[model samples]
Target: MQGHGYGQPVKQPPHTAWLVLLRVLFVAIGLFSIGFLAWAMMLRLAAVTRRSLDWGLFIAVLAADILSIALLSMEPGDEIRTTSGNFAMFLLLGTLVATIAYYLAADIRHFMQREQAYAAQRTAQAAYAYRGPASPHTPPPMPHTPVPRTPPATPPPQRPAPTHIEQVRAELDELSDYLRKHDGRHDSHESGR
Candidate 1:
């Protein structure tokens, strides 16, 4: 009646306190549902890499939602309506919010687990590079055994001597050295002239 227009029917506005209380209750229930789902999933995930599709909080939420709807359907002025399901729609909305949050949490968990597995595999591959390839110049790791300093009875097999490329490189190097020496001499003679 406070906000009623001259020709308009009286409209009842919900009390500020009741509205605030109902909103808070809805948010609290929704948050509780989400948190419960996340905690249960995390525990289950710890048991195995495969996620559990079954949610423990799901039954609780469904029960609460059903209870709220039943209470809301009661006639106004009935003791049931006043005592229970007073904020039926709000509680129902809360359940929806909780469900949405639960699914998001599951998706995030799956994505994060996949990323962790990929990173671990990549790290295992990189570990080979971290130690790096053995160089021919460096000696191989010696065995832990401590042998006497006696020389070998027979010499080890000799490696084949440097071949064609080595011969060509040596020849080219000698020719280059000769040309450099002559060029210096020619330069000095020209300077003198």
Candidate 2:
């Protein structure tokens, strides 16, 4: 049987593995830039730890990209070609990291919203059930009386609609009965045969 998917596992984005690989590279670049290359790492450490690591990583990535860009711009022709590979890698990793992060955040937000809605609905149903009926004098609504069901009166045992096959069978039976009435075959047909 044919399926709509390309054999990927359920509920995963198409390029998730590639995104994961890029994230690894992105992390390496971020660590390298902040650890030994940039002087602002210490200054940003407290803020980044307190707030969001994403902003710190983003700043590190930016500094790395700028450094790579500047180094590549100073290189000669063939050297530039060789060194540009690192810059390209960083650029591609950055884009993938940002894209995956955005999508992940959106997915988390939607999941939280869906969970909250479900929780609200459950609470509302619980409250309604606890409150019972609006009027205490009124009896609880009896679950709809069951329509006095009596096997639907057996619907008079209706004969089914005749399909083409059934009609053909009946016609064949009628023909056999007619042949039997006429001494098995028409005289003219037997003579011709």
User: Over the stretch 33-84, how does candidate 1's per-residue lDDT look in tens digits?
Assistant: 6433323333333333343443445456557666766767784754544645
Which model scores highest in TM-score?
Answer: 1
Instruction: Single out the weakest 10-residue window by summed lDDT for candidate 1.
Output: 1-10
In candidate 1 the C-alpha lDDT for residue 143 amounts to: 26
TM-score of each: 0.33, 0.27
Clash counts for all predictions: 0, 0
In angstroms, give how far residue 178 of model 1 lies from its true place. 43
lDDT of 2 by residue, 1-193 (tens): 2323322222323254654564455445445553233223322332323445545554654565566556656666645365465665566456445534543454344344444455544543444344343332453333222222234445654678753333544666677778777974577678887
Cand. 1 TM to true fold: 0.33
CA shift of 79, model 1, Å: 16
